[model samples]
Target: MKRAEQVTFGGGGLDRAAHLRGDRGALATAWADPAAAVLLVWQGKPLSTRSGRGSSPDQLVMIRPDHPLAASHRENCIFLGLAPTGAPQFACDISSWQPDALDQAMLASFADASEQQHPDLPTGQVFTELRRMMAFLTPLEAELAATANAVLSWHKSHQFCACCGQPSQVAQAGWQRNCAACNTSHFPRTDPVVIMLITHGDQVLLGRSPGWPVGMYSLLAGFVEPGETLEAAVRREVLEEAGVKVGAVTYLSSQPWPFPMSLMFGCAGIALGRELTIDHSEIEDALWISRADMMTVFAGDHPGIRPTRKGSIAHFLLQNWLADTLD
Candidate 1:
């Protein structure tokens, strides 16, 4: 796990200026700085330059703070942090702006392939699904995009105070919400999920959800329940989903999955036995695949199995396991 942080959405050395979160004076100066830039998010998607056909990678589009679109949505801005060059970085949600002729069906789909273009924004820049572009973005851009999406999603869902049943207001530069009625402060939440790589001998366990694509399969995963440790979660999830007993669980790496704010904890576990009694309610199918067959799956030659999606912790763990680099 030495290279654990190399996972997608891992730490990219972004200076999240937490000390300045409550300093209104410092925030004002940073906002007014000429080098300040704002990243735009629309309905959970981040604005990005489309990837080119050649060697160029898709990039997060950071526009000037004074831009008309950003200025109009200034109240919705969240102070992300400072860039390496000391420029202030912020994220603004322009989800209120509706694109012309937008396809509502596609937008509501599980895999939203549509890219939205604002009439006022620069040409070639569109709000694209983060899952579609995550692997193509730089490490720093991936981190920033994940942070912005998670925090904004939190704001959208937690508009009311749980303590006093009153509306809450944004505070601490979008990192905190304060309720005046009860004087309670709430922070963004990241649910922890344990995705296990369960192995016995040379074979690994994988399962596919009911509606997943025919050949798509991945490591078994589940949310960590209250009062449960990561190791316990892994064992419990594998047992519940596939009826496989796991032992000697060890942490591997983690990825920030911002499809609504989740931190996926990738772990390796030894299967006590190979027998599987798949709980049909939890998964459509479960099987044990040997290393050789997994290699075939990764190479796209296996007719029955498909590789896990790139940028996911499961993909990273499996790739490393194949290369014997999961140290």
Candidate 2:
């Protein structure tokens, strides 16, 4: 756990200027600064410069504040923070813009492989799925994109006040919503999820959902319910999904999983027994794989299983476990 923050979307040293969130004058001044830049999000995807066929890395496309698109959406801009060089960073949602020949079906699929291009933007810069490009982005880019997507998704889903059931207005530089009717303030929410790496002897437990691709499996995970601790969540989730009792749970690392806003808490647990009576409703299959077989899976030599996605906490934990570096 010493390298806990080394996980993707956790170690980035982004200077989130929280002091300026409620300062309208300071925000306006920062917005007018020449060093100010904006990132545009369309349908939950951030605009990025596509990576080349070989060596290039995909980067977030930083648009000038004065750009036509950014300017038009200025009223709804969220102040993300300041860059390392003191430049102001902001994000705007342009989900209203429709593209030509748009395939609605692909956009709603499990994995959206399509890229969207705006007519006014430069060529090669498209709004791509974050999941598809997360592993290839720089640490800072990953952090910024995750923050923007989470905050924007929150605003879209929580437009009304929970207290008075009245429409709320953006406040605190997009970090909060205020309702005039009840004078109530609501902040962006981040749900906590516990993903466990349960082991017995030299074997680890993994499960695949019903619709997962063939040969794909990952550590069992579930949401942390109200009044439940992280340790309790891990034990309960493993037992519920795979009928495996877990004990001695310990925290490992965490990742900001912004697939609609979640913080994944990666933890290690010891399994009391190797027997797996998978709950068919919770998972399609569950099994215990030894360390040797897991190595083959990581190396693409295993015929029955594929490696977990890169940039995910599951892969990070499993890799560290394989190298005896989980401590």
C-alpha lDDT of all candidate models, in order: 0.91, 0.92
Can you give the lDDT of residue 17 in candidate 1?
96
Off by over 4 Å in 1: 51-55
Sum up the clashes in candidate 1: 1
lDDT per residue as tens, model 1, 27-63? 8899899999899999999999874335787789999
Models 1 onward score TM values of 0.97, 0.97
Cα error of candidate 2 at position 216, Å: 1.4
Q: List the pairs of residues colliding in candidate 2.
A: 1-327
Model 2 C-alpha lDDT per residue in residues 221-279, reported as the tens digit of each score: 99999999999999999999999998899999999999899999999999999888889
